[model samples]
Target: MAKYANGHLPARDRFAHWRELLSGTHAPMTLSSERADDFLARQHVVALGEVTVWPAVFPPVTFRRTRELIRRSDPESYHLTLMLRGSGIADWRHRTLRTSPGTFHTSDSSRPVEIRSWAERGRIMMIGVEVPKAVLPLPRRLADRAVGLPVPDDQGVGALLSHTLRRLVRDLPEYRLADGPRLGEVVAGLTATVLGQVTDGESALPPHVHRETTALRVRAFVEQHLGDPDLSPALIAAAHHISTSYLHRVFRAEDVTVGTLIRQRRLRRARAELADPRWDGVPIQTIAARWCFTGAQFSRSFRTAYDMTPGEYRGLRGGDGPGV
Candidate 1:
């Protein structure tokens, strides 16, 4: 019999092939079951019908059903089960998990495991993300040790990733064709984050991956407009298709500010020119203008920052200084 009686297939196809396969109509259940099996195989578990994901402080899942799922699916993915309702017990080769609300349990797909729910009858939310065995960074020797480790939902990168995933699932259908690439990236990042947590920081899965992926674009935009005297927050934001507030937020996260960082960089370049003996009498205004600085204002900020006026600092450095 199919475990998922309500959600496994669309309601319209409830009476046709889907229901027939669940009833075990065909022999060996191999050929006829291939479709359902293939679909289930993609994920680590399956049900004869639909599975309702509820939002309680904690989540719940059927222990017996969970065991059946493990035995039947035997996949290569990872499962993170968060108990939200009542309670439950997870039995593995040698350990037992007494699950409660707000607590989580993890398991690998290649093992034999059992999950038993508490007597009160509870429900839980299960998050599943697949990682190929061959690509797992940690040695098998230590991989299993992380199983059943409770993921605290309060803080840290894990919490951030968990929150993002929960929000994504809640708005799953909104991810359509136009958003496929972004959705895929989000999925990859979230999966990496979970893996890193499971492996105890042995993985390089963090939000920085996304940041780096787009860093080149940011750098290019800033460089191309290096000569704009008004190359300020509003200009940068408009060029990058983001809000000025968001641009500032990104710079702040990097331990700098949009305007301050740009000004510092510009001053550094200007100082290099001032030190060049070739431009010995280039005029302070000329040097500042060459670097896209606002003449007098640049000199003021530069002096305030470096503790000396531009010309004075220039003469002290004796030309031939830094480069591009």
Candidate 2:
């Protein structure tokens, strides 16, 4: 991840520095801000393979990509913007629309477009994903339909995509650079699914993308129900209205069975708590049970996975201080 802030620069030079930084990171564009005299903004960017996720906060501004700029160079990518704390207006293909928090707006780098953003109180904040056009799993005509359209993110697949992007931005520091390609693949898959659904062209996506999308949804369900002792392959499949055998097939692409994934995630959660100094007062059995593991089962599994008994591991981490 890379972070950039203009606060360190002199007030007079801040906006210019931001412009240069924007040109280097994103597509070339002309930026004009009423607060340019002392612009305050910061951005964090994470590169996932060919895609980049950038979350930024800045004051009111207008961004324009002109025909002249496109003539000079084009990244041939689609920029998807998710408004987190503000509202904006986007103009593209002779269409203009307003976007608010929990909504999405897209733009194509191959064309000229203008976007003006502002907030009622503080600065505008948003997450933007730059995906290569050629990598999109939809036909060009269908993908084009999504540009400049206001996509409501409060329901259905749009909501899932919105949550995924937001979570990625929020928990980005927890991920290593080596995880980029795989993470990028997941993001690209979800993005394709959302775009296809928005354009009423879901049938256009390849079979693998659909499988991956279903797997992603299933994993999210598992995460939400991790503490349920009854959680199993049958229950998970039933929740999604799919058969257990089919669920297994879906996870075949992940090279792990559904049950194993659940167990791994549960153990990981328990282990994290066991190692935390704040959890020192919590009993090992209680922590294990909190993650849906029986006392004996938790000890066995933790030793198998981490090569140490839970008590020993907790003691090593100072979790065995005084509180028992």
Q: Among these predicted structures, which one has the highest lDDT?
A: 2
Error of 1 at 209 (Å): 4.5
| Regions more than 4 Å wrong, model 2 | 152-156, 170-176, 277-282, 321-324
Q: Which candidate is the best by TM-score?
A: 2
CA lDDT of every candidate: 0.52, 0.86
Over 201-311, each residue of candidate 2 has an lDDT whose tens digit, in order, gives 889998898888888888888888999999999998888888988889989989999999999999999889888888888788888889998889998999999999888
RMSD of each: 17.8, 2.7
Question: Can you tell me which runs of candidate 1 are displaced by over 4 Å?
Answer: 1-73, 119-122, 125-142, 178-185, 203-324
**Inter-residue clash pairs, candidate 2:** none
| 161-219 per-residue lDDT for model 1 (tens digits) | 45554665566556554564454454444444555566775444344654532343455
